[model samples]
Target: MDMTPLLLAEIQFLASFSFLALFMALALALSWMLLFFKLRVRLTGDAGWTAAYRFWVRIFALCFALALAACLPVLAQLGSLWGGLMDKIGNVAGPLLGYAVLSVFVLKSCFLGVMLFGQRRVSDTVHTLSVFMVALGLLLATAWMAAVHSWMQTPDGVAMVDGRYQVYDWFQVIFNPSFGWSLSLTVLGAALAASFLIMGVTALQALRRPPGDGERCAFKTALIVAVLASLLQALAASGMGDVISRYQPVKAATLAGYWHSGDEPELILLGWPDAATQTNRVLLAIHDTGGRWLGHDSKGYLGLDKFTGPRPPVALSFWLLRVSALLALMMSVASVLTLMRTLRRRMDLAALGLFWRKVLVGMSFSGSLLVVLGWCVSLVGLLPYAVNRSINLSDVFSQATSSTLLLSIAGYTALYVVLIAAFLGMLLHAVRYGVVPVRKTTGGAA
Candidate 1:
């Protein structure tokens, strides 16, 4: 008698939420370097801007701590929850994961300590260097994680040995075709999320009272960076879609509720996908642009109707993609308009009107929402296959019993609720109380 792996939707959703928390921290950590470097150059004539640097460093430390805490459970889930997948692929993923933890996390946490505590102890030069190091660590860590996911999706550079997937080329596993584009999108998404969050915080402050020069400066910086990131995201979105259309046409077709194959197919812009009926009712669509949009001679491209396999829910993925893309574009437009207004006012919030202030407050979470949406589109889109063509979800999922799963779900749910509450509570408390006053340095000290 042999036990079989059982795919649990609940477990998958839980794992996704765990990753969401980790990514939120990653975005904050990655964005700190941009904020620091940008502020350093823009806030000229302050002898390395020591006053401003100190203010941002405290905020960075708080975010770093939260991110570190959120990631612990996600790592534990690999062994405890998804034991079946780990039993098979642990020999391969374990080493890659260990290297990332040892190299990236250690480097980041060590430097983060220096940035937080060594401001007065170490020289300003060392502290500034630590900031850059922490940022580098974040990027590298993100890259490693992306590589792991990419390998999972494509499953190249591995061979089946004695009924198990084994890595033959370590370099190939980390350098998959999707690695570069995935990392780029992740970085840009982080920038977008971090920028909006900072802007939102400052905007909330502005609403409480007329913004001071520092507040105005922060708003301007965040808005400008966010707008730039949005533009880049727009530029990257098409290329990413094209890659999916070419490499994973099933996902591309599902994204647009595209079912039947046709020449010069229209791109469905707005529609309600009815998976049961295998049809979509449309309100808007582009005409005869599939070939031009997806690739050269897009008429030659495949469709979801042609795919013969067990697939994920279609309506959910389609709606998610539409919402995420639309929200992203809307934010881009809003950011650009806000940037123009800030520039016209000479970076003074007093000159900024009330209407835009309200709008900014409402739109502060736009980037974070986009981050969550994009993750949904990607992860849900790659369903049924834990390792693309190699490992089906039915073969890689956990084999926990009903009673065990019930207890696990209940326990994890409680734990998740507590962790999320604590994280948000701390963040809110910090925002409400943690105001670092900028003091003029006697001799260029933070």
Candidate 2:
């Protein structure tokens, strides 16, 4: 009755996602500040703003470096724990740990160096190159992580050789089912987050004072790019459907509240999920209940019932699947409408109307939160299956020793508590300080 393997797997997954969400949110907030400082520097032609901006970036660079450094060991442990639970090889811990540490240091230090290099000169080309290089490094690292995740989903081109898992054509594993769509969606989501933050910071500056010519010019340019990028992100996300439907139908159906296999499922709007019973208590009006809402006919809808009998909990799947899809739809609509209004010279319409400011913030925070949430629910939801796969209690008991199972779980709990505190503190500070004040300068930029 040692539930150590299952428990450890759950702990590692939860901890990794919790840390990642916190890191991204912090990074986004710092990016917003740096962008604002940079704008002030350009508008006033004052060295003070530039100095502040550089300092902020320096702090960001340092923090990101440290955060990544700390995550490497945890990530290694998580991989090892997951592998052991899956009955995979154990020797992967060494190579993976080394790679994780090396990748973080190399990537973070290189980006920091690029930022420092850009500060000493004023060439737009140099700045552009620096940004490009940083983007490239991030993409490479992301590709690696994506490969690992994709392998977890559809492990292709790998076979157990001589009692060890040997990867055949690593590229095949990397490009497994849904890899393209997943990678594209991930990159687009990152860009969307970055763009939204940029727009928000710029808009906050506009609210503080009427924009000067230089500020106005920069804001206009950024708005166009951000809006376009956001639009592209939505389109890219739509591409996730085909892949999801083909390979991960269960996930797709759950997200859409689609209870069946069919052509063109209608999305579910409001439904109360019962974890104890794999039934979605319908809420609100439903013109197309089963067919359109769950994307399945009467027979297809019955498939959902099959998912619920004494196995990995179907209730969580139903809930998370719906939540993730719902969030995606909401963000897509918000991004499009906001962009259209901004382009029409109705900044107020986009910024003020429909409580867009609050909505924007909510969307950003919710997106990050849901990622962690969905991951947790999914892992927990899968626990029963994992338990079923195990040989016996003795085998499981042996795996948990020296694995630091309880420690990982405790660490995850602590990290999440700290994250909530940090989030609240930021909100309070933002409200108290308000937007940064714009400085009037001796004339405009030369």
Point to the candidate with the largest TM-score.
1
TM-score for all models, in order of appearance: 0.87, 0.68
Clashes of each: 1, 4
What is the lDDT of every predicted structure here? 0.67, 0.50
| lDDT score for residue 219 of model 2 | 40
lDDT per residue as tens, model 1, 1-446: 12222445435454545445445544454446444653464456443344334444555665566566656766766655565776667666777777667656676658867766665677667767777777777766667777877777656678888768788888888887666667677777877876777677667667777665555555666677787889988777777776776666677777767777776577788889887788889889887775543322335656677789877568888898889889988888888777777776765556657777777777766777777777777777787666665566666555667666656566767776776577557656655655566443445545
What TM-score quantifies how close candidate 1 is to the native fold? Answer: 0.87
Candidate 2 deviant stretches above 4 angstroms? 1-12, 21-63, 66-70, 79-103, 121-128, 203-238, 250-267, 273-278, 284-312, 346-364, 370-411, 415-446
Cα error, residue 131 of model 2, in Å, equals 3.3
Clash pairs detected, candidate 1: 291-298
